[model samples]
Target: MALSSTQTDHLRRVDAIGDPPARPTLVPAERYHSPAFAQLEVERMWPRVWQVACTVDHVAEPGDYFEYRCGPYSVLIVHGDDGVLRAFQNACRHRGNALCTGAGSSLRELKCGYHGWTWDLAGALKRIPNRKGFGTVHMSEFPLAPVQVDTWERLVFVNLDTSAMPLADYLEAVPTDIAWCGLGDFRCYATMTIAVDANWKTIADGYSETYHVQTLHPELHRCMDDVYAPQMIWGHTGKSESLYGVPSPRLSGALSDEEVWDAYVYTQGPLMGVAEGTPFPRDQQGAGQSVADVIAAQIKQFAAGRGVDIDWATTDQVMRLHQYNVFPNMTFLASADHLTVMTSLPGPDPDRGELVMTLMTRMPAQAPRTRPADVHMSAADAHPGVVMSQDIAVLTGLQRGMHQPGFTHLVLSSEERRIINMHRNLERYLDLPEAERISEAAAGG
Candidate 1:
């Protein structure tokens, strides 16, 4: 397959990761189900690395608050009356009761439900039920334990380690890589948290590569050129770009333009307001325009209807999906008029995890902000999209497969380097012994 002009430029601009290993990469299967390893992640990785807690929309107005939980750790994010965003350890200073449970607006103060201890929106201890009962209890002495909080584009992120690097630095080159997409213009309208019976890494690995599209996502394969998809790595962050609205080059036969259109509609017609079984508008194709060009035009029209101007975007910009993966368990894919952010959080045990999806749409500048509708569902009830549903359906089996006695390690190809990069980052944080680190097997061994 030949690389497009934009793809050529993308390859030339960034410092690519090292070439594919000479043989299959091996990762231990026990990491997926080991209780001790999970504990290590909870202590070392979750507390130290920056993670997307919620979207700015979730806490857009003063007094709005959202609770983010990973494993047993909970962080409460609040929009203060002073026009500042703040996060705390979500524990009351007195008796260690949770100050808040879920998310809502119009919060006057952080009041503990159990003992009636309270704090101001800025996290300063303001009131105590009985001042005389406690000896020398200074309000200033016991403010809420602070957590580092910041925003990138419209997504809010929190880090328990106050000394961790700024979110911008932690993201490496990802921010500058997709600045052309104007991510700030996209407004999150909803989020879905689906409970899955799979390890968090199992859920995350599904998004880290395109290697499964040919077999697992046939409809997606017909609309995306997975073979020519290129990737780049930058320390804790990396990205993959795949052109859509075309048939996969791996397909044996040439598909007609209408066939390609149907595949795209079946996979992601909602993006352009197209209904299922909608036929391609043959008349819509102008001279020298390909199927991708027509799809890009339709997307532009959809954006204009919402008062969002994407006229400056070219076909390549709108048709290519840029996927960025943040270490541990965060991945977001964006195009000129689309954005979806996903994250996986560890559940009660190593065999369980939750996949949270943040759905966004491009909106006109100065669009009124509203709190996003957040919903939680079991895996059986989740139907985020055709492609996403497919991804979710395989998690349980993939997780259970790792526990088989004969399944010792996962053999990975270079196409899955993003997943490999995640393990590399995990090793740095967990300080795994040399014996547990990943290695490449010698060819034909």
Candidate 2:
């Protein structure tokens, strides 16, 4: 689809934001605390973009369903008896009462609390409590409004606009890139959601850089590498992949040949050596050599090769933390053995929002291969109530601080530029005149 003249102008405006400067800073007050900006975002951005709902794991069986909120809008995902997953506005057509309450479940019909109006799983109005007073009422035209719903891998997604472009087009190359990370096979071992005092962007920005690992998480620093670099893949739907290469142990400290060999054998066993079929040496690191020492040596070698100076002793790499901010409102984190998906929903109060995190994995019975108990991984935790507490503290604080007169803009590093890019994309969507920015992109746009 050819871009409308208005959309073309919008794109030009985005390009004018410039290739992004070296030190782009955002005004904390405008973005974090301004109620005006939040309302504008809800109007311009929330409805037009694709947002994650949940995963197939949560509603795998027919009649299974889940409910999600986007701004003031409530949505229900229903798996009909015919095995099709559909989304509907959680409201009745008669008096605009909420239709389905709580999370969705197997049911012959959904009855409203305010009035006895009922809808079938397919969203068709099946009954009205009193037919006598509504002699001329047309139920056919009053069926629930439908929303766009689709799936990628096993995750469910919904868009408020019924005419929006197909989900596949919006996703672009992201699916293939995630496959490269072996995400399709990853099982959810644990999941967490914490309320933050800062904006949703703040939560995302915090995870984008490893600059905080050394200071914020001293214990994790001791076990991981210090150099955290992210590679950006740009498009309508983009991705940023961060790589943390494990350092070899021999370089960290002076070690006897026996101890060095043993250290290499033990630490590398699960990661590099096992795939190579190397035997585990008896004395992996010398009696005097610590895991930290081996890691330091590995880091030095890598930095030397890249002409960069960073410490491995103070870095963390085993968890291979990855945050995939899928455009609009969904972000996924992939650890070495688990995956967590976080979805942001707009709130009635612009300052407050709802976030849902879902963890998924293959059932043990469904797996063809069997591993020993020591090697077996556990399921991911989906309840993020605790982790969210820590996030809420910082986010709320930041949001409040944005109200200060001294706060103006945020300075960002080249490494942290992705956050700015995200904001730019958001601006592009939100700035479009109400009519020009349609719900779905045309086929070829």
Candidate 3:
């Protein structure tokens, strides 16, 4: 099932031209409800792509390890004793049982709890618990399987496909774009994954565009460009994003553009993270500058206090904390001096999933990095951040509403090009032939 029957037919029809069906709007509801579609994604899409497994800080020391699970696949990302990062199938060599159920640290070697079969950090079998008990076991051929892995801007990613393209090529300009915002310098501060009663795409799509901000996250207009920027959108490593810090031209209700600008410049404090008591320069417009310019001046002052220098005048404030949606599941929200990294994994069914949200920023070099927080989910009032809570709060209802017979297709907006981009990319992976998927991924197709 595709976003719509037309979405499905159109894809098959125009695919000969090397372009995807233009799913600008009216996506089929089956995209979120079809079990076959979900299975296709799991079998065809998830395995052959580059996915963020964890942050460098998560496995900062040799022996520190974490498990990355997607569907039936489990990968153990280890900081090898060689002082390099490596990923391996988490199953034991003997009897193919999981070597480790969860994350742990300071393990000199991987010892299977099932039978105590052991392997070294180099993924070489070191011992079998019962030496004489395994006459048929071939130790030479039984080492943990390795997966393709790499790092960028402290993010560790893994690809199940051996032939997949190098991480740098697939990622293209994402790092460069983040570096431009100075977010490449930020470090992970706090991270958490929340289970949501919606499809992973539903949650990811919510963050990709600002089409719903005025109706969904009205408060965000205080400092966000709810409208998508066309020119810069394509420059984001071939991804789509919604910029922050600049007011949305599509104001909620009937507010004037001047009022939006006034709110953008004048609204201070936690709402926009302005210095606690920073006052607005003027009530109307600040010194005859555009919204982005006015925001830069105020933020530059605020950032100066924190010892970070930004190109105040020219820095596109919209990207100060923009949300960049990488294909598959990762969405990196690079804000001024920090980022909110988000990714998702499917649940028992694809319609439900776990969404991990990490609030990351630079801690002074001397500060110890904090571990990720436990899983949590709550309504707008209870979730830590009201903005985020609101997004999560509507998911359950949204998921159910998506299945309503009357709501058979999605009505997207111009600002929602990101969702379209993601879907098309997803279809590319799904439609790929099994034999070619791995090879094409390796080629960064």
Candidate 4:
């Protein structure tokens, strides 16, 4: 017999509470300075989560390999002789030295630099410098430790737990959402790495909102439509984000003289357009109109040739940036034309963190694509790694400020609540009894 409507509603409500809709602010100290908390997080929260390591393009050939970190653990991604992608603990069994220090082409065996103990791509022990030194020793028992590895949409991920849930199960709605954004068809364009003196959460918190756009990036802010607000997505393993809409000045037909001036200023400012002479002044009449009005004007003018009345400023097309924070340490941001993945891992110092950004594009078949010589900046300059460096500075400063004797709690904006929800999920996962925490599926139907 089928269940009644009331029963369905009850089940839905129960699920919502299990993954609560609202949560309290995460105390600054809990995240920024606590070693005990960080360790517990690694053991409980990170091990069960899905983390992005690298792209399939990095190791496309049979022998290609890449190395990445899952929280504090270093993992090696290898394409074995059997033509399978595998992930293993990068540490060697003999003297605890890292097996692979960097990324490169395929290797038949990964040999330890410290002691020369060797293991194949499949992580099976193949060679020992002196087998007879240890009498009656079993080589099979010394194979490298394996980690749970999987791929989706050509991205690689590793989980420390041997029996962790499948990547799809943990990802929940992210795959379908990414498909909606047309990310599968998009390729990487550039990549950069920034080492920062702050907690990983600090870097993530900065990306979660558009509130900083107006002040933090005054020059770039002119091109952005500020009227539309951001929309948040709830109820998944971690924090998932989607923008409802953004202002598009080019689509809006109401651009005033002042709006045009702002656009010219933005275009001329070190990045986009570069033409000589002072920019035109804002039209006095256009100065009073909303930013949306000016954007509408520009969009109409630009679209008239294409035969469309669409106002990109008021339209949803402007809301193209989609970001997914895949619990604990990775954030994936995508737009119609570009994609960037940021991985945040804990550093040796409690007050510092390391971030690696991998930017990619569709692999072209023959002719190599190169940045235009006339362009003032490289791809990295276009999408300045300095922006992340700025964030790192702020996060580290915030980390230090949290320890002040006068500081006690935090005041959070509605938009900043996502960080709070992230902490709550961490707590829920960490607090679960060992048996109950095994797998979401095991919690029962």
lDDT by residue (1-445, candidate 3, tens digit) is 0122322222232111123334435566777878888899888888899998888877888998989888788999998899988899888876788877667789799888887888889899888877887667777788889999898877889999989989888887777765656554667755676877889888888877665767877766755654443313442234444444445545433554445445544433442355433454456344445444455555665555666555443445433445666778888766565567888778788668878876676444565666554455533234556577778888899899988889867766545667766766776878945432211112222
Better of 1 and 4 by TM-score: 1
Highest TM-score: which candidate? 1
**lDDT tens readout by residue for model 1, 396-441:** 8999999999999999888899998899999999998898899997
Give candidates' CA RMSD values in order: 2.4, 13.0, 9.3, 10.5
lDDT of 2: 0.56
Model 2, position 275, has a per-residue lDDT of 30
lDDT of 3: 0.67
Alpha-carbon runs more than 4 Å astray in model 4: 1-28, 70-72, 225-227, 234-319, 362-393, 432-445
Top lDDT model: 1
Candidate 4 lDDT over 334-393, as tens digits, reads: 643336777776766556676667664333234243321111222223344334444554
Q: Positional deviation of 155 in candidate 3, in angstroms?
A: 0.8
Arrange candidates by lDDT, descending.
Answer: 1, 3, 4, 2
Instruction: Put down candidate 2 lDDT per residue, 32-131, tens digits, no spaces.
Output: 5567777877777777778887666556667777776666768888888889998998888889988765454566677788878888888988888787
The residue ranges of model 2 lying beyond 4 angstroms of the native Cα positions read: 1-23, 181-192, 226-228, 243-321, 347-350, 362-393, 432-445
lDDT of 1: 0.90
